[model samples]
Target: MKTCRFILSSGLMLFAAAGFSQSDSTGLPGDDFSLQGALALFKRSSSVEEFEKLLNTESSNVNNLDLNNDGQTDYVKVIDKFEGGVHAFILQVPVAENENQDIAVIELEKNGNESAHLQIIGDEDIYGEEVIVEPDGDDAGTAMMMPSSGARYDHGPAAWLTRANTIVVNVWTWPVVRFVYSPSYVVWVSPWHWTRRPVWWRPWRPVSWNVWRPRRAVYARHYVVVKQRRVVGARQVYRPMRSTSAIVRTRYSASVGRYRATRTSTTIQGKNGRKVKVTKTKVRRRR
Candidate 1:
């Protein structure tokens, strides 16, 4: 019997917010790299090698990450790691001579010959949290209607809504995903590095947050944030190899600091268990 399950972790549960469209969104370093965009590109790619080229292609417009703060956009390399039925495609960038930063991971777990589940997780150091995005199921359309930024948003229907509701996304239907699960599949590790890259590739300067946000939204609308780790096997295999770049972390911290300085309000849980919106107030400190 083929079975798919998502194991939820215990913590402070947060309702799924519309993708990066909050009023208080001042943007972070993570904004430059879009997991939604990556997933969209991945779907179009036929193989891992082609996916790597698409990621670094100048005209693709899917990648805008400049993790090293260099004048040019970073070349994203793909590395596939697999164990049993789980495969983790680590999307990484060479930030320094001897250092590489993992931007996000495309995780897939095969439940049967024709059944698989997939999700992409953004690295916390870059994204400020464990952001998981997967394809929107047909039933996702039936989620409760709520107004968000002038558009209707749906929080999928479940008996009990928690931080993230489970949905079945059979990635086996995706060509590249199914190819990776085949017996003849070979693990793909990108050969192109900082000094050695494809002649067709040309890096461009990173754009301002304001300009990139809209481009990102185009891809973001196709995905949904799910907090639960459905592919447990893939998660376990990736944890040991998962890495964060110190350089990216430093830049992320600076971006966060700047964002906090201009933030107006924050949400907190009230005594009655409902969410309370608390406005920011400047309290003059006594001399």
Candidate 2:
């Protein structure tokens, strides 16, 4: 009930879920900072204060934002985890809503940790340690700064995006699972990665994760530009909305300074035979 359930294209739906973990993942730092340990602590935390204390200890840095405008910070970030070829991201606030907010549970292999490309976005296999989660979708996908090259790479756990530097694309409001991670810094993750089956600690029946939420702001588009160690531009534009379910896939032609979104949807005929939906998605890539 804590999740803000909005109408998915149409019709408002409500769902709740819960689960917990007392186990830890090996092969990571094997310390409290590891994803598994953080999950263990979040599951058993008796109070919000205690959960945040655990988060502060495990993360190298934290990004604070008032997601609902309540003026109280709702999110605390952690490290990234890879399980069975998918990245399992854990955010603080261990509850039924946050538990189900997770889209995938990853299981990691012992020796393959370093070489694992957690996912192939836009068909490019990106290593797990290099991804970033930009909460604001400000064109700058969450990135890790490589000291050797002085360049940042787009690494957030998003769906349907091109490889690093091709032109970062996200569905703005559509949810894609992501872990708050930094390559050079310590991170906390979820033990959900260890389980192959869905955990049933919820007091009620579980529902689908598709109602699969994206961890960061998934409703807009951003193209971030950083030049000379400074962010020159970061822009977020809303995606085209429709009355029916649709999927928008976008490709950027860097030479043209524009983003073209090809949206596909099915329209239901009303009594008047009116089918309502956005036939096209057009957003100018801000410079």
Candidate 3:
């Protein structure tokens, strides 16, 4: 009898080990997912049932994610069979702020053999900012963080979370301007000059003077200035300009003539159609 009992015990141990090895190889059929992979799966799958089929697993428990905060829950879960592991993730469905009841459980595997459970302790509001948490045993968790205060715009990672609550997952919100900088170096060229030059070169040569008069020159300076403007859902904001400057210079032709002019007056203008007053001062001899 003792010998028979030993044999039976040994046989059971082998069977259990084999089963565990098989489970590892197949990856729980449904519970095997990287944290990001699980969130991606949730976004793509329409329903809990669809999610399970896609993930090749079921949920041990699905409930609101508002673990403590009072709000509508926007999270769900899927579980693996052999070890009873849980994967907590969020759904993409739009919900009222603070409402936490949109979540649902897709599958449950509870056998003496393997069992897992997931619970939401608070509201999903924790997602307003990035949140990090440690995983529970074999379970994983994920959450999303909003863009920082005074963020330039709403262009960045839409969501983020960890593979397991214990594992750290990071999501970044990239600035929209990062992808696009306003066109710089605006040149105000004469329409006549632009038409005469090749289309490609027009941007480089903004102003031109008649080639016949080499002394008559035309040039432009480029500089940027900040201006205020309102954007959708935002208050007045400062925007950068690509270029700003005086485009043209006034010209004056002068013939020699004496004129009283102030020291501060640097600009010389032609007077009396025939001659221009080029100002010069003379010292008087006191006798």
lDDT of 3 at 195: 17
lDDT of 2 by residue, 219-254 (tens): 223323222211111101001110110110111122
For residues 1-287, could you state the per-residue lDDT of candidate 1 as single tens digits?
12222223211122233332343344465677778778778888889988888888766667888888778899889999988878899999888877788889999886554556678998867665567887765422222212334543232222112233344555556678867877798999888776888888878998766566677777766677765676788888888997666777776787656544543688999997999997553421100
Q: Which has the greatest TM-score?
A: 1
TM-scores, each model vs. reference: 0.71, 0.23, 0.16
Report lDDT per candidate: 0.70, 0.25, 0.24
Which candidate would rank higher by lDDT, 1 or 3?
1
Candidate 3 Cα misplacement greater than 4 A, ranges: 1-6, 11-37, 40-89, 92-287
How many pairs collide in each candidate, listed in order?
Answer: 0, 24, 31
Quick one: best lDDT, which candidate?
Answer: 1
RMSD of each: 15.6, 19.9, 37.9
Pairs that collide in candidate 1 are: none
| Candidate with better lDDT, 1 vs 2 | 1
The per-residue C-alpha lDDT of model 2 at residue 173 equals: 20
The ten-residue window of minimal lDDT in model 3 covers 247-256
